[model samples]
Target: MNITESIKFNKLKEENEALKEQLEMAHYFNQNLGKELDKLKQQILYKEDFDVLAEMYYDYCLKDNSKYDKLLSKEGE
Candidate 1:
């Protein structure tokens, strides 16, 4: 290949590697954020007020947490 083409190819390779590294870091960060959010949610459920608990329960409903209904049932019982 010509000198110019080789330089362009190297630049492209470097960019691709940088993008891959960035993507991996983003995924790792998102995963950790998700875990931290879950922990914060648990803390909220235990420590926060009822309105916050209700919102958390709504989110739990989307996840189909069966414990929510059980808790409600026991409350009514």
Candidate 2:
């Protein structure tokens, strides 16, 4: 292959490798988030006091808006 062809091939290969790493990281993050959500559900399930559970749920709900904003910005990128 000529020098130009070699350079193009190397660049494409690097981009592909970077994409694969990002995908792997995303998968790992998603799996861990799922585990955490499941644990939170269990905590709510095991809570005997209805008032405490409700308060916890309410406090957690307030964070949803910020989470959505971050998700939107990430998606836009």
Candidate 3:
């Protein structure tokens, strides 16, 4: 190849190598992001389950207090 053509080819080859490295890094970053998204979805589901259970427990406590008050009144009398 002529001198100018050879220089251009070498520069192009270097650029290609740099682009490949960047592509690999982006793929790896995307995979990790996918994993993190899955984890976040699971955490949200767990939080929803916990919130439902807490609400149920609170409702039960409110209902039970009435019965407890009767027992206390009986004991005092």
Candidate 4:
């Protein structure tokens, strides 16, 4: 190849390598985010269960419906 052609080929090769590195990084990030999302989902389930138990206690033990009513109000909002 001419000098000019060789220079262009080297530049293109560098760009290709850079793009491969970027793709690998993206794949790693996606996997990490997926794991985080799974953890968040488990946390949400725990929270929902706790909320239900608390509401039951408020309604039956305390005989107060105000908090439950407020919860419903917040849901609407």
C-alpha local distance difference test of each model: 0.70, 0.69, 0.70, 0.73
Query: Which digits, one per residue and each the tens of the lDDT, describe model 4 over residues 38-70?
Result: 997555333344467878787645467555444
The 10 consecutive residues of candidate 2 with the worst lDDT sum are: 68-77
Per-model tally of clashing residue pairs: 0, 0, 0, 0
The segments of candidate 1 whose C-alpha lies over 4 angstroms from its true place after superposition are 46-77
TM-score of decoy 1:
0.55
Q: What TM value does model 3 have?
A: 0.60
lDDT of 4: 0.73
> How do all the candidates rank in terms of TM-score, highest first?
3, 4, 2, 1
Which stretches of model 2 miss by more than 4 angstroms?
45-77
RMSD each, Å = 11.4, 12.6, 14.3, 5.2
Can you give the lDDT of residue 50 in candidate 3? 41
Give the number of colliding residue pairs in candidate 3: 0
Higher-TM-score candidate among 2 and 3? 3
Off by over 4 Å in 3: 46-77
Which order, best to worst by lDDT? Answer: 4, 3, 1, 2
> What is candidate 3's lDDT per residue for 3-75, written digit by digit as tens?
9999999999999999999999999999999999999755533334444677878764344545434332222
How far residue 16's Cα lies from its native spot in candidate 4, in Å, is 0.7
